[model samples]
Target: MNQLELLRKFTTIVADTSDIDSICKYKPEDATTNPSLILKAVNLHENQKFLNQAVEYAKKKGGSKQEQLLNASDKILVDLGVEILKYIPGYISSEVDARLSFNQDKCIVKAKKIVEMYENQGVSRKRVLIKLAATWECIKAAEELKKDNIFCNLTLLFSFAQARACAESKVFLISPFVGRIYDWYIAQNLMSNFPHNEDPGVISVKKIYNFYKKHNYKTIIMGASFRNVKQILLLSGCDRLTISPLLLKELESNNTVFNRKLIPPTTFIKPPVSLSEEEFRWEHNQDEMAVQKLSEGIRNFGKDQILLEKIISKLM
Candidate 1:
């Protein structure tokens, strides 16, 4: 069996892309998209139709310039998600605006709007995972959304504190970014070349996986942002892995003997105490890598979202 097939025996493979052709080719169990990916897709000629539809809908819906822009942005995101969902059998994550990361109420409102837009298009809420930053406010917002049967994927997670909060909130899943974490360490010269087993990013996800499995927490751990196949191989038995199509193609072509590196332990262990808002903030602040990466991720996503909106504005 190829590496991708072998890995599927232990982990649920998720395609991390906005390109329809890639998603169709890989057939990932689920699909995930963010502002950045959506922006990339919208620029493609094939996806411009969705952009035109969203802009036209926004113009017809008629509101203030700001409101129209917001509507067009959300519409385009949901439209793209709707199209992706048609190809995958499982969930497709649609991210809330990165600008709402720090605002609990705004995050909740935007998430609901995204879901409602999906529903209006005859898509089921069960097939959509509202993606939010792992801010304390967003976590709190997720807690509320879960009550309404609206599941969420807590993303941009870097520190254990973020994971802890998401787990405590009983979110459906948390995406601990492997590649971003690895990138931060490498850029800081904190570590040089290392074997796959010892990769810092892999180590972080393993720790979170162990903590969840040990405590019997139901929250799922999906490792994301992999820089290489080795990083993905290291977390073979993680609950799920959202991989880019580039890496997916690599796995598909390579027929290697992939071994399961992580498994849930049968014996239960005491979990760490839940963190309060203040405690969560302080812990996040202390982790230099997490702090820097989370901020940078949000900024980059926000910038892409603005660029996407500019494209829509041009069409309007």
Candidate 2:
């Protein structure tokens, strides 16, 4: 079997894109979309119609061009997501505003609103997973949403404490970022003599995954934001992985053997301990990498989202 087939035996592979065509081709069990993916898709040659239609819809909404553009862009995002869901059996993740990452109530309200938009178009709650930053407030927001039967995918996670908090709160899924971790290590010139199988991001996710497996937490661990095939291969046996289409294609073409490289929680090299809110906060504060990445990821997404909104305004 190819690497993709081998990995599938032990892990769920999810497509990380907003392109329904690509999702249908790969037939990923699930798919994830963010402003970055959506923005990229709408700009692609084949996705122009979708973007044009969104602009036209905004014009017909009978508002100022700017308001129409914003409405249309969000509508297009929801529409594309709903379309993608039609092809996959599992849930499709749609993100909330990164600006609301720190506001529990706002995150809950926006998540509910996004779900409602999907429901309005006849999409079921079981087929949608709301995406949020792995902030304390977002975790609390996810708790509230889960109570209402809404699943969540906590994105931008880069630390053990974030995973622990999510697992403890019983959130549906956690996406511990891999690429951003590699990016940090490279930026710090630590990759020159980097040790194989001991990647910083891979290690972080392993720590989180072992914790979940040991505790039997229902929250699934999804290693996301991959930098290359090496990281993906190292995490072949993870609960799930959200990989870009390019990486997915690479895995499919490479005829290399792949196996579950992870040792289960029982083989852990460290003891476990439960964390209180204060403890979680302190641990997160101590992890300079997570602290910096979480802030940078949020800022970048927020900036992109703003730029997207500006594009909408011009189209209006």
Candidate 3:
């Protein structure tokens, strides 16, 4: 088998784009979409129909033009998700607005609205995971959502504190960005060696994986935002790995010997410790890399969201 197929034997592969063709091409177990990916898919001529469908739904539903456009933007995500679900048996991540990331009540409200949208189209809540930012407020929002049996994938995750807080909140899963973490260190000139095993990004994921396993948190560790194939290879045996189509294509062609790296420990290390808001903030801030990357990621996603609204406005 090629590396992609081989990797799938141990880890659940999730497609990280909104492109249905790529998801069909890679055939991942699950797929995720963000404002950036939705915007990319919106701009594609081949996928123009889905965008139009969203726009129509928004207009028919009716509201102020601004509200209509926001509904249209969200519908675009759910519309693609509905299509992606037809191909993948597992969950499809429909993200809450990043602008709601810092508001507990607003995040909860947005998440519920996204879930409601998916259900309106005959998609079950079980097959949809609300993707939210990893801020403390969002985590708390996820905690509330979980109580109602709505699962979530905490995104833009960068530090142990974030992972631990998610665990404490009993979130369904998390997407710890490997490439973004590596990029931060590179920007700071902190890398001298590039050994696959010693890779900072790989190391960060491993730490979170080991901790979750040791503590037996039910939350799945999904390694995401990989910079290269080596990062994916090193994160072998993670609960899941969301890969982009470009890298998925690269993995599909390579035939190489590889081994599972993240073996869950049988012995319980300790009960998972909880993180208070202050504790979460302090611990997360201690890691300069995590702090910078988390803010940067939110800003980037927010920018794409605005651009997506602009795209919708032009069509209206």
**Which candidate number would show the highest lDDT if scored against the true structure?**
1
Q: After superposition, how far is residue 124 of candidate 2 from its true place, in Å?
A: 0.2
Model 2: how far residue 288 lies from native, Å: 0.7
C-alpha lDDT (0 to 100) for residue 230 of candidate 1: 93
TM-score of 2: 0.91
State the lDDT of candidate 1 residue by residue for 175-244, as single tens digits. 9999999999888887756663588999999999988999999999999999999999999999999999
Cα deviation of 142, candidate 3, in Å: 0.6
Once superposed on the true structure, which residue ranges of model 3 sit more than 4 Å away at CA?
193-196
Put down candidate 3 lDDT per residue, 296-315, tens digits, no spaces. 88888989999998888877
* TM-scores of the models, in the order given: 0.97, 0.91, 0.97
Better of 1 and 3 by TM-score: 1
lDDT of each: 0.92, 0.86, 0.91
Candidates 2 and 3 compared: the better one by TM-score is: 3
Q: After superposition, how far is residue 120 of candidate 3 from its true place, in Å?
A: 1.0
lDDT for 61 in candidate 2 is 70
For every candidate, C-alpha RMSD to the true structure in Å = 1.2, 2.7, 1.3
**After superposition, which runs of candidate 1 have C-alpha atoms over 4 Å from their true positions?**
193-197
Clashes of 3: 0
Best by TM-score: 1
lDDT of 1: 0.92
